[model samples]
Target: MMPHQPSQWICAGRFPPPYDGQSLLTQELLELLSPEFSFIRADATARPPEGRIYAPGRLRLRRIPEMFRYIHHLRWLTTRYPLPILYAIFSGNPLGHIRDCVTFAWAIPRRRPVVVWTHNALLSLHASPLWHRTLHWLTRRATLFVFAGRSLYEPLRDILPEEQIAIIPNLVRRALLCSQTEVERKLAHADVSSRLRLLFVGHMLPEKGGWQLLEAAFLLRRHGVPFQLTYVGGWVTSHDASAFTRRIAELGLSRQIVHHGSIRDPETLRQLYLSHHLFLLPTKHPTEAQPTSILEALNAGCAVIGTPHATLPEIIQPGVNGFLVLQHPREIAEAIAHYWHNPNLWYSHARAARQLFVERFHPDRIRQQWIELLRRVQQSIPELAQVTT
Candidate 1:
């Protein structure tokens, strides 16, 4: 066992066994940081661990009750720990926003250093001016503000001091990197004789461009281009599922498209990446901070194609590691055809993509950055060191 550092940290965030980005990130942080820190996790949607329950699921009864319970819990935890820092990984839900505000306000009185992990692009969200003001106020009071992408860092740098804002991009494990020789061997055996294998790995929401990707696939088929497309994630909403299914049928793409619904296991996800030749995600949402799917694909050595939205441009260099396209389906189809004509482009780009992942987005490399940020927060709060040790 690794020697535990004397500092104790209570991680308040959304955590698995629920499959979402926030949950995955929280779990990853716990796994990487627990060896050095005495960590306790408090999940929003999960049952409390044994001996940590402040109350039952009574918070689900009403909004006011939930608010009350949240405040009570925040006060109790801070009072009990009285530690130097409280790191919160918050989503953009209304309830969560309020809870974060309350917790930050309470922490301020105790002089506890607070760190807020932002997964969403807050300024891009269609929030009311009042809500924006509240967010600004809360962020100004935080000891450190951590962003998953540089795009987010630009907008928030002025709100917090330069040193207080940390840009730690999401990462993929090193084991996911497959050798080019291995990828080629698997492709040869898969019998993809006539068609290029294109994979889309995200939810079926409109913002994720499910409709756009499906349309591009149809256009490719119409142009007599030989390619197969597979989608490998669940629907975001009921309406999204209905619309996606209707579009797939209307376009007569049943023969060219395979919809492989949610695959959660890490091993299975890596296998999907290895089996596919290209990964496409033309997400239209400007508020999207960063998508882990892109990193996972790069780690698996797949040639990537996505829109130049949010942090995508920071990750993908056009015509280098991958191609970035406009929102038009025709443009996407054209890019696909270009790659089909020059298969070596895919090999070269895939190699570059994997090299980039190893250089910056590897889990072990990024985890050190996170530890350094936590240590800075500790230094800012001298009282926390006394309580935690």
Candidate 2:
């Protein structure tokens, strides 16, 4: 598919802190694609910069107000730009889904192609049957549907045609791709006596498998495994915070496990990844489609450990790039111990993981895939041209 210069592309979704995988991806996409395309953004968080305007306010408001704000933003865009391509990154929350639906409804009349980027499989599944039918109808009317992983493709396959669904993996920044040599050098510099430095970079939520990880850490420690577990990312809910802290105390992993809270800055995150020996995200959430942290870990040349849920299998080739354990904390501990005891195995897996990141999660490669998908969608839906032309 030949890439045509889009007059403008308006990325409408919740962005950055409130830090989510989708929001980070949106920001990365804008950074990479803006040089070539006239980019405008509409975020549910803060009002974007003057030229690329974003709707103000966090997305925790009432349904009516959110809808009104979204509609107002859409109306503003229509008036400002020649019906630009609407890239809507859907959220799993009820209000977010409603906002997406409203955005789709608004786009239909304008005949602008709507690109629905989803990170959750159940986003299509858990909706009302009527809503699903309506979504299918709207999907057929849409120009494209982008998913973070192929795991999400099956449920929505019946709605949008296979051709319209683009499976573009989550991408990480080029700087995040630390070479094995660099990682080794950093690890040497950190100079921890422990053979393994396991790091978990996500929220301290149960759904994120924080408690499970702490349990696993305790088990590993009891068995005399020499390793450290560092938990990054802030606690979103109070329950998540309290549960995580309590578990840490209960497990007596105070010395072995440390909560670094949230590290929002990208450079700092990269430094954390570089300093770590392994990355573990035991996310058991059914809603988690693809985690950028895993990709970031892989990119940083760290051996990864994840649960066999969501897109973990897709990213981590067990015994090859990383390990994928069941929900059992014992199993997680065993896997951690396996990597901890064997430096050669750890290095090999770490190298393979970084290679996987280069091939699958590099920003330029993924961005090209996105461009190709957009081109295909534009060609299939002639109405898209009508809006931009």
Candidate 3:
């Protein structure tokens, strides 16, 4: 028998530049899916001007030209790699819907198989009815819908059949994971002697619960708890930044809290996770899918404390790997105190956190799931001859 040819694919999504969860997850998909399969890249990153940052949710008029450039690139790639399976990332906003519509407009006419991947559970969070209608129309023809976690299936359950939907959780890079020996040592000596080291790693916005976390820290201090809370992300807006500064001084938490802006170095981030005993993300953001920082903390054996939002409950089994709390300062402070009062519980949960990562979010497990899903997508479509240059 002739050797089977690997299926060709056109993987389309933003890679990085802004380095948010979606882009980083897209980068992970490329790394795991490449080499074995041939692909034509259709990058969706809008390289906004030097000083301007790319915001995924907001509609920027200046970026319209860049959108056209993206469409042109995809058109050129499609002509050359005819009938290649289209795999794309689905953004949750209207601007993102328009981009998806344009991308799908080409492939749907050709009857090409398309796989749509979404990293957020923002469909139900949209205020307008049009965003809902638009997404339903755009994804009506998709061959498969991939979700970052099973909890993310609620918004799409009515639109797509259960078979068409696949739940493949996000994967952490090997470099970010700690070795078994390292995890053991870290778990054994979790710095219970000193003040507890707590970490918060997301945008310093109110919706991300940064303000709530600060309030939680104040409550912890008021209870005579000796702990240090560190903030490690950029301020989303000038108003939020000013408010954060004023509130920190108001709460008298300058001595107990530290804000390090944004740390882009992976090694620095990895070390931060290792050194901390607890991770906090009480986010109520509409676009949060799976916070990768939680996975990093789990990998580093830091017990997590987060709000029960999106896929967080699946990641954090309350009283096991972590505790999921309401997005309130009192509840968050109580959860932290729960760990602080019982050093043994914290140690046990820290080890359980690492075990959970290895069993659920490890690269090897996720890579296999992607391989199987890709094979199914490839098999469902009829092969087409490649265009000769």
Query: Residue 103's C-alpha lDDT in candidate 3?
Result: 70
- Can you rank all candidates by lDDT, best first? 3, 1, 2
> What local lDDT score does residue 77 receive in model 2, on the 0 to 100 scale?
71
Write model 2 residue lDDT over 1-389, tens digit each, in one string.
22334545776766675555567777777777655555566766542322122222235344466557766886677556654454656655444566667766664344656777775555534456646765666676667778888877766666667877788887786556666687668645643336578898865556777778778888888888888888886655556567777778887877887777766577888888997888988887746888888998988888888988888889989999888888779988998888656666777887798788877787878888877766666566566655443
Provide the lowest-lDDT 10-residue window in model 2.
Answer: 48-57
- The total of clashing pairs for model 3 equals 0
Query: Residue-wise lDDT of candidate 1 within 339-362, one digit each (tens)?
Result: 677777877787788788878888
lDDT string for model 3 (90-206, tens) is 776667777777877863344666777776675553446767666777667677888888878776677667988889888886667788888888877677645789999876667
True lDDT of residue 377, candidate 2: 60
Q: How close is candidate 3 to the true structure, as a TM-score?
A: 0.91
Which of candidates 2 and 3 is the stronger one according to TM-score? 3
lDDT of each: 0.71, 0.70, 0.78
Candidate number that wins on lDDT, 1 or 2: 1
- TM for every model, in the order presented, reads 0.86, 0.86, 0.91
lDDT of 2: 0.70
